[model samples]
Target: MASSLGKLSGRRVCSVALGSGLPRSRTLGPAGGRICLSALGGTGSAQIRGLGSGSGTGGVGAGGGARRAPWLVAGLAAGLAGVAAAAFHHLAPAEMVPRTEVASSVPDKADDLALRCSSFMTQPVTALSELRARPGDMKTQMELLIMETQSQVCQALAQLDRGATFAVDRWERKEGGGGISCVLQDGHIFEKAGVSVSVVHGVLSEEAEKQMRSRGKKFKTKNGQLPFCAMGVSSVIHPKNPHVPTIHFNYRYFEIEEADGTRQWWFGGGCDLTPTYLNKEDAVHFHQTLKDACDQHDPGFYPKFKKWCDDYFFIKHRGERRGIGGIFFDDLDSPSKEDIFRFVQSCARAFIPSYIPLVKKHCNDPFTPQEKHWQQLRRGRYVEFNLLYDRGTKFGLFTPGSRIESILMSMPLTARWEYMHAPSENSREAEILEVLSHPKDWVH
Candidate 1:
């Protein structure tokens, strides 16, 4: 049977008796250093000493000449052991590790990783047992990454809000696979925020197939249908303060098995911002963070994807963009699966540093009722782009047995559409509209 240990703070201590009848103890420090303590049985005096890597002998013992009674030495060792035991007991759940089993078993590396995954906000769509069993599979690896990303983003947003926590929903599709959706609504800091991860498998619909084909995806189909699996983490955060920009991000992996039993896959997603009121500093910071992440992988990525985002999120009918752009890419199966996965992971990790500071800086900024109305109207534009032009939204809606709530979680809670609405010339609202109409290159 396999087992795990509780959270052991500081160092781990183990005791053994030497052949010379002296009881020796070794403590493993956090950084892999070791301390060895031995007591001379006859004198009942203990020598507290340190040991370096591969060292045969201990260092000079502290208080070498001091003499102690046998009973005292015994009592001291027993007391220290008791304190260590108590510390372990109070720190973790009682069922995490049994006291009787600690000496006989230590958690292996696999168990440690599994324990971390188990700490996610909600149970993973794929069973933990299956994830551990198929560690080498790309599908399993992508699922784990998305789950980890979802938990991290959700936790970060909750901390910023300080008053409201996310409500989690775990649902399984009747066809195959499932997902976890976390939403925080009507909070003091955020009006609506959703972070969701899904692992869904099904046959692609003709509409979806056509959409993919339009993007240059080549597929060999039997009976005009292709079986596919898709997994990703997506988030849209709508902050209450108009000054704080709303942010959206998604990173996903897609695979389809062709009629000839051949398989093809790709990765896609990006992060962008939509602010009601323009802030050059905020826009620059957000784009710069994303650029740095992209630069680490490839210098060409930021420029290419930034323009793609600007074009992809455009509200074509309105003749303007959804927001000041970030990076967006799709049908990315190049450079090898492993390489692309790593690049996607890097982009996913960049979300926090890119957006959190803007929130902290403007979450408390003052605004009037008119400004609030302007914010709502701006959100109406956000709604327009997502529903009408967002590929992910369309794909989700077209999928069989898709969760409607999770698919629409990207929409802001409140929005207004006033016909013939336009900001006054040279007003702050007009400033943002100008930039949206003609996108700016914030990073260079």
Candidate 2:
């Protein structure tokens, strides 16, 4: 008797049969598309056809089948069950599998993203894997942006200097997160340039909270402590040539989780210029570049933030502004988080375009010892303002886990203070002082 077991082409198959007393089995190569289980007086055969390529037939001897038939049938049944399960798995629909299971199997894709992230000046304060895991998170997005901006600005400055590259420092805070600081000092072109990015989270101290409240922040605290997270990219570049002008810019995001589990977030920052000798054209170009970036988001942003920059970077006791103003804004949570992020991104990207051209234009310009002295005097004032009045500086100093080096990276390499020292009246030095005393609108 011969029993048909159906086609097995391109599929796995198993079968069992009983005949005479003998019991034996053999596997077969591809033989047409049909499979068969046959039994005769002296022989029994089970053939698997089209299992792969080519063709053949297989058989089992039946001499001892009477005694071993029951055991053979039981063992073959178990083997057939296993083979059926494997076939079901191989032919199962893709939708039947869980999405996470599919994603977890592709580690090569995750590694590729990590490799791309490594191109930054240093590794991110947050792990790349975590960043990949939370693509929609604002915190992750902000950290990645600042790190990328830091790397770009450092590379741009190094290209212009052609002699020195930034020295990288990666540090961590015991309390929560960490940061990367890149500095290029005493280069052929840049006197001192520092660009840093930090992602830190911890409980806000009393002084820090007081400062925040003073700035109009209202937070619900738990037991007099507020949990906060801050991340930003800040840079100050002072060129070797006094004519090149100094530039400073910082953009940041902050979040505070209230006692009730509610969260409040905001963005803040700006860019400004300080010069030993006032070059009207350079000032105009710098302000115009910033204006263009702001105009893309809101036309009124330039004028409003420009005034804020003037007011924020002021030397109160000296009764003068810090530099030719660009733009400054704080406590911004308006329009929409996405809209504000795009606006901030636009402004951050404007740094290189706004300032690098001025460097290229004035880096090779001639400068006298007197002008250098004037530059040093201006730097002295820069130090005074940052140490005494800069809110970011003060906040960083007050924060327990903040990196002190990054907080003070904005300070110039050298500065000078002389008793009752004054620039000669109506000279280029005094002219800049006059502008500093009275801020001007470089663009219409």
Candidate 2 whole-model C-alpha lDDT, 0 to 1: 0.67
lDDT of 1 by residue, 1-444 (tens): 000000001111221111112234333334533322332122222222111111112111121211111111111221111212112222211111112322112235557555666446645667666777888899988887888898788777766664343545445566677665666655556767777777877788787788888988899999988998888888889887788899988888889999999999988889999998899999999999999999988999999999998898889899999889899998899999999999999999999999999888887677777888898999998888877877777776666665555656777878999989988989999999999999998977
lDDT of 2 by residue, 1-444 (tens): 000000001111223221111333433214422222332111234321111111111111121111111011111222111222112222211111111211121245547656556556646778766888998889988888888898789878766764343545445566777665566655566667777777778788787889889978899999988998888888888777788888888888889999999999988888899887899999999999999999999999999999999988889989888888899998899988889999999998999999889888877666667777788999898888888888887777666755444666777778999989888888998899999999998997
Residue 285 CA error for candidate 1 (Å)? 0.6
Query: What TM-score quantifies how close candidate 1 is to the native fold?
Result: 0.75
What are the RMSDs of all candidates, in order?
A: 17.9, 27.6
Q: List the residue pairs that clash in candidate 1.
A: none
Q: Model 2: residues >4 Å from true position, as ranges? A: 1-112
Cα lDDT, model 2, residue 45: 42
